[model samples]
Target: MEPRCHSWTHWADEVVLMSDTTSRLLIEDARKALVRRLVSVCGQRDLIEAYVGWILGDKTKEFVDFEAAALASKLRISEPGRTYRDVAVLGFAEHLSPHLDTLYALRKGLDWMLGRRPFLPNREPDFEVDGIALLGMAVGILASGEWEKRKESEKWFIALLAETLRRSRFELWDRSLIYAAQLLITKESTAEREITPDLALALAAKGFISVKEDYERKALELIVNQPNYAEQQVDVVATRLAALNWLMRQVPTVLPNRAAPEDVINLLERVRDSLRRWCWEEKPRVRKAEAVPVKWEILNEYHVQDLLWVILAPIFPDLEDEENLPSLGHKHPRCDLGIPSLRLIIEVKFIYNGTSSEFSRIIEEVASDASLYLSNDSGYDKIIVFVWDNSRRIEQHGELRQGLKKLQGVREAIVVPRPGKMRA
Candidate 1:
């Protein structure tokens, strides 16, 4: 019987290993297919060829020089056939080139272009109306890093991109382009909290799978089946490729190993368990002349929140404390702690005593907070309530937790008793 059990366990382990291998192979295949598609599309247009080369770091000096020469000729002749929009694309491509001379020329060209239509905050710029041009200029400015040189041309370009992202509708492809540029500039810190969900929705609308789930596979699909070679389609495909590459390098995979809502609940349970053994006694000690115990205690909701924040910060770098929720009607609600990346809000409750009245009030307060928070545009999808019951009412905890769980958006409720021997 022992031999048979060992054989069965070994067989299960092999099966699990094989499953993981298969999944990895599928992911690799999907990535390769996307790269192949991108390469094929890059051949269709010079602008895309240059832009993608810059994005993928496949730029060749010979090709950059040739592209630069062509753009310079167009600018010099003031090509009757070329509109200012075309000049913007040329400027974008020129910036992607490695030549210093081309960059200087491109700066002058941008100055002329801006003279035609200066940056006006209130008025919509022509580039904003033209998604391809907008992205072209934005990407060009970023690739050149001229904005760092304190150049007015690049500064204006940055301002334009920032305003475009701020003002554009989330549903529009323009917003996605500007958001992608923003991501490239900030390297995924500044705008991620606000734009990620909207970007996912936009990608979904384009028939790509949710960016939150299986983005690599869906992004491959979007690139391979890029319906047309129209300028707008090219811009969209290019933006998607750039965004995908950035995600692959800088962002963690949202796959089989990504943390889920359940993992957060488990973490909270661990936190609660750790708090059980908190301090030498009910209060923390200071090793002065002797081990002097301070009167510091988890006295209120803020105290509970601060303790939780210290424990959670090392784990979640993006954790926010006292994050304000959108105002609903006349009431302004604030979350005790929020993990933006997880879209999880944590509300800490401190019950002075585990009395029935106190428990009832917690239920009502949690319920009210839930309605306001979940219904807001704050982007949090779930809530976890952490309750510190100082009254040691372990009996009422089960009922209180159950009642809190029933509230909408309350993913889990944790009730932790004050450590034994701690003065209430």
Candidate 2:
């Protein structure tokens, strides 16, 4: 036989054709019959039952009718009365009810769980909302193989489990253990998230292989084998920095101090040393009886900034390089390296072939850079100049250093060895 309320559209149209009083009476009667039939139906019924019950005067039997033992036996509840099974039922009803708003139902359901409302349905709920909500959340957990998405449900379940355990007082075969286990295993069909004592003990009993080492090995393989980029011109240093940062984040537990500035600098120095040791172009040898002068390969300020980025990323993920100085009511100067967290500013200067003009210009530039850095209200505590003397031409280095030190906010100036100098 065809279901009477199967075609809601036809029913709705027929209702509209009836007189107002007659239509209201018909709707009220149909709702009453639906609610009565719902109580009799068994084995995973729709959440629509709750919506219908609420609409048809939300009247239902109270827990007084249910003997805890009988209820436990019938529903296979391991520990009866230990959990707010009614809340789970309501949440399920809300989730599945087309007529009920999801969030509204959730709020109402949570209110019952939190004891804000002393009772749900003004008595015994038509269905266990809490159980069904947990079951549904378990389905999500199993499908995603993650615990975070079901965080709200998990939190409630843990609290419920805790309360049940407390009431049972850790007794063997108690309702608390049974209820908690049932909730955990509710919808876990494949046993993917099963936390049984046997399984835990079995895992602990076995000798486990180091999976992390294998994962790292594969990662290293990819890093070494893969080209920097498949297409277009990509900066090699930038690519290397990105790969290194990814490795750090992926295995943060293995790293000494993840995201610490000094730790980042240490990592950077390792890369810098490797690059200086192997990546630089070597000078050509002169033939016998031939006089040929060889100039050292010099790296510009921008290239040096890229090298700084390799070390800075682990500590200061937000560290800015070549950032434009804030317009502090003067000509806007650009920073070579600026660590906002440390309030530290670094200016990099490289003198090529050390001519008198070049020497004078770079010295003046460092002094001006210090002046600009100090004048700005960027709240920088220290400014340091790193000068790479490629030509080794500066005589009386102490006097030149003193001149730079005289500038306001200027800290100690240091001359760094070039890659070519290190090669020698």
Candidate 3:
């Protein structure tokens, strides 16, 4: 029989069609019809029986009734209740009923097992939705439209599985709840973005993650998929951080703080440090000082501060009387090598074409406020500059080129180009 859902405008086609149509008709009668059509009629019996009790009685949920267990037993094993419930479900599927609870349960049960949790043996005799079928069903259930019963079922399952998997490898969530979560991951809409960094950081405090290390790792993975899952990510990572931080505080179980590999940290830092260059170069250099020898003389960026001072001393050869000028010194904060009066700070940056804006921001922040990089501007005659690899900057508007820009207070600025390495 064709599914009623196909003809019915507002129902799952398979659901409405796989119903148990046995009242005026007999199971024998329906079987013959299906066999003639070459349909296996698999699981149709249970499907039809489940919804039949209600469909015959005004389509209300009140149809979920049961006779006395003692009386039901004498009538034969096909009587109502869980024992012969499978038959009704199969019948419903065969006739293509708009109702389907057995399928939902089967999908949920399979999900619990898939998460590698300890589960009570599903006593139901197996049919189509088993193993691979279960996984496939889970994906469908998750991706399906709004389902209230599904959510409620998932919550109960999660709570139950928590107890079941408490002593198992699936301890992250209750064994019962694993299906619920899988449903969420699978069924949740991709368009509704809610992930964020603050959320990811907070998951450590919430106890969802036992170790900060594990939390960070998983958070990154989750972010790749859900960049905007602000709330859940925070709650999850916060839990992990809380657990990991607690473990760290205990003197005996002490592990190194943030055990992420140094190489990884260095690589990440280099990437971030690279962004500073991008922020600039997109905008024309607004001059705050005279355009001195724009290029700084540097053998390499290793001793960038030393190289900046070396380049500047010749450009602005010191006046004999002005011993109170900002001098070059490695200990100074801003110049990183310049003295009080002779301030000359320079960062060895590898500026890329795409990253000029980012670099501009970093350099601007450092340069805009002299106090930030240089302490006393007694004779702060020069502004610090950092140019990495590429110095050929093209800044223009229409057919006009804005003249070289300058920073206030500083007499001139120099650009130190790092050699060899090139950016595409």
Q: Residue 239 in model 3: shift from native, Å?
A: 61
- Which candidate, 2 or 3, has the higher TM-score? 2
- Give candidate 2's TM-score: 0.32
The alpha-carbon deviation from the true structure for residue 155 of candidate 1, after best TM-score superposition, in angstroms, is: 36
Give the local distance difference test score of model 1.
0.56
Q: Write the per-residue lDDT of candidate 2 for residues 66-174, one digit (tens) a residue.
A: 2222223223222334334444433333322223323333333343344423224467532232322334333222222222324455555555544433433322212
Top-scoring candidate (TM-score): 1
- Once fitted onto the true fold, the runs of candidate 2 whose alpha carbons sit more than 4 angstroms away are 1-276, 281-297, 394-397, 421-424
Model-by-model lDDT, in order?
A: 0.56, 0.40, 0.30
Q: What would the per-residue lDDT of candidate 1 be over residues 1-424, giving only the tens digit for each residue?
A: 0111111122221111213566546445544544545545533334455444443332233223336433543456254554455545554554334342345444444555566554466875666555555555554443343233426655565666666555545444545455555553444544433333324433332222225544434443444334443433433444454544433332223334555667768877887567556664533455567656655577788888888887777666556787655444335567889765567889999888567888999999999888877752345778999998888889998899899999999999998888775765
Displacement of the residue 290 alpha carbon in candidate 3, Å: 48
True-vs-predicted CA distance for residue 8, candidate 2, Å = 57
Scored by lDDT, the top model is: 1
Give each prediction's root-mean-square deviation over alpha carbons.
16.6, 27.1, 29.1
Over the stretch 1-424, how does candidate 3's per-residue lDDT look in tens digits? 1111211133222221112463213323432332222222112323222333212222212222212211222232233343323332332221122233233333333333334333447843232212212222333333222344446534543454334324333222222123323333333322112222223233222211122343343432332233232333222322232222332222111222322222222322343245333322323365666533232333334544353344444433221111222212212122333322123323333334425564555446545445433332222334433433344443311111111124443432333233323332
Score every model by TM-score: 0.47, 0.32, 0.20
> Which model is ahead, 1 or 2, in terms of TM-score?
1
Ten residues in sequence with the least summed lDDT for candidate 3 = 396-405
- How many residue pairs clash in each candidate at the backbone level? 0, 10, 108
